[model samples]
Target: MSISVHLDRITDPIVAQDERHAGSSVRQPELRVLMATRYGRLGASSRLRLLQYAEPLAEQGILSTARPFLSDNYVKALYEGRSRLPAVLAAYARAPALRAAVQEHDIVWIEKELLPFLPALFERALLGANKKFILDFDDAWFLRYGGEGEAGGRNRLVRTLLGGKFPTLLRRAALTIVANETLRDWALRAGAANVLLLPTVVDLDHYPPTAMPTNPVFTIGWIGTPVTAPYLARLAEPLRQLSAEAPLELLVIGAPDFTLPGVTCRHLPWSEATEAAMISQCDVGIMPLPDDAWARGKSGYKLIQYMAAGRPTIGSPVGANTTIVEDGVTGFLAGPAATWADRLRRLRDDPPRRQAMGSAARLRVAADYALQATAPRLAAAIRSIAAR
Candidate 1:
């Protein structure tokens, strides 16, 4: 139901609050942190926001254990367009166990809510008087309740019941960690008292900057799961236009069956073992998102990956993309409907410029979005919340 957060540097007394072992015997305070994640490792939010923090936090003597509401099977089913009703029901059935597991930990670091699609009253009641919890959000999850688009069209009763869910959780959390300024602003507006902006990051060790591969055709890369593949499809018109004028290859990773009629689209099954290497094969990277509330919540992780791989990026000028790409310096930010083709053309014709931009992009990522740079702060933040 839950995993225990073990502090290797601290004795058991701190967990028990035994003052006798607190003064000198303990090197560091022992704190058990429960990672109440939404989904298992297959979910990017859980993987990047919660699971990846385990090793980094352990380095600072804090051990974190995660218990996801939804299993990998649920995520796999969702990605494959299969029915997830069975998995969803199974997750809801496990809710009580997760609720009961909360009492055993010092702090609960939650990725989104412990349960989704339920009313906030029930979710809060499930948490049950525990104030030692931190909330993390990488997406504008609140938008799903009643903001716009499909969310606004939900059944009136469901919308009324769920619209205030995130705000209620935010106001109660000991701390709130958001992936970008957009999410941070939303949390602040929702009455969150203490908030921290921690962007989605790549481990620099795994994402080594490599020289662009010498290929016969210029390649533009995009990496994302099937759910996000539709965003990449927005560039079809631009890519189609570009393909007509030049030898272009659209390297799509993760979504193995993606295709564009006129463009030479190459699909590679995404694997951790080959992602970095696959990214290296690109001359440039692209993240094309529509301007919308849900899209605005994105952390621009695709651009970060591209930057880390020493490839210049061109992203839709929305949310984190505006901040991640330094316009003309590290990468370009163009409207998906406006200048995508023109921007792609610029990078295609200039090899030297691409190299220079890639270098700049990598440097920017190392300085700000690298996991190594933020791990200490993240550990400290969680430790501080646990101590409180």
Candidate 2:
């Protein structure tokens, strides 16, 4: 309940001292990192963005221990539309654990904060405890406290208390890693002293293209969580029009209820193992996002995954999507409903062009967006911050 109580519950003074001494010890070559992950590996921010650094950084002798605020059970329950009170309490209980883990490490890498919704001042015990804090953000969480995540009702009260603290967290952090340039600018405006842009990337070895589909039916695919499900709805009119003019099918992974009239909509649950195969199944992958501040902060992870799978992507011409899609090369950045239909028609009708784009997409990923390409940069950033 109280700060003292939490510290008393999990604080390990001996371990803390050992960590402090380890920092001065010249014998140790590896850097110990205590990662305050927002969720387990299932969460993209934690998995693709942060956790992927573990193996590569380890090779460079940076060992990391992840202490997740939310558990797998909490994520499963929340996605199922269940009450989040139990999960909230469970996550709250882990705050002290994370604080304790932060003690024996050279650096603390947090996805966001020690806990969301709590007052930003509460961060000092977990972060400001004389540690090199690497605060990583993959989304525009500042909007949540202002409006986005709040659904009115009693949650508004939570939003009010949690409001306006993202800036404070950025300012307090030793280093901030943001997913896009938009968020990096926000962090700079928030007074963050050090910031780095680390967009979401994929391991090509793990997500190489599958055998091209032999079916005559053209398939347009989308993969994301339920919250982004509505983004696909924005394409309904254009997709419906495209289907009427041609034989097109839709596969919605992670959103079971997503439907497009005149198109046969199929759904599949999101699974790490099957996600690559699912992306490969598409003749074209689509990422539709509204052009807004929140959308601008997106890292265009879906587009990268699609490109890595060697499926040409059709993305909204917004934020990082613009840079990743490489319009007319790896994919097209469709602006309006007509543009969406036009690009869909082009990719659908031109097999040679589509195959060329897919090949180029794979090459683009291998060149820039692959985990190997980015991991070294991240490790270098961490090393630079640590030395400072």
lDDT of 1 at 79: 84
Pairs with backbone N, CA or C atoms under 3 Å apart (clashes), candidate 2: none
- Candidate 2 per-residue C-alpha lDDT over 257-301 given as tens digits, one digit per residue, 9 for 90 to 100: 777666789899999888999888889999998888788889999
Which tens-of-lDDT digit does each residue in 318-354 have in candidate 1? Answer: 9989989999999899994558888889999999999
The number of the candidate with the highest lDDT is: 1
> How well does candidate 2 score on lDDT at residue 341?
91
Query: What TM value does model 2 have?
Result: 0.89
lDDT of 1: 0.82
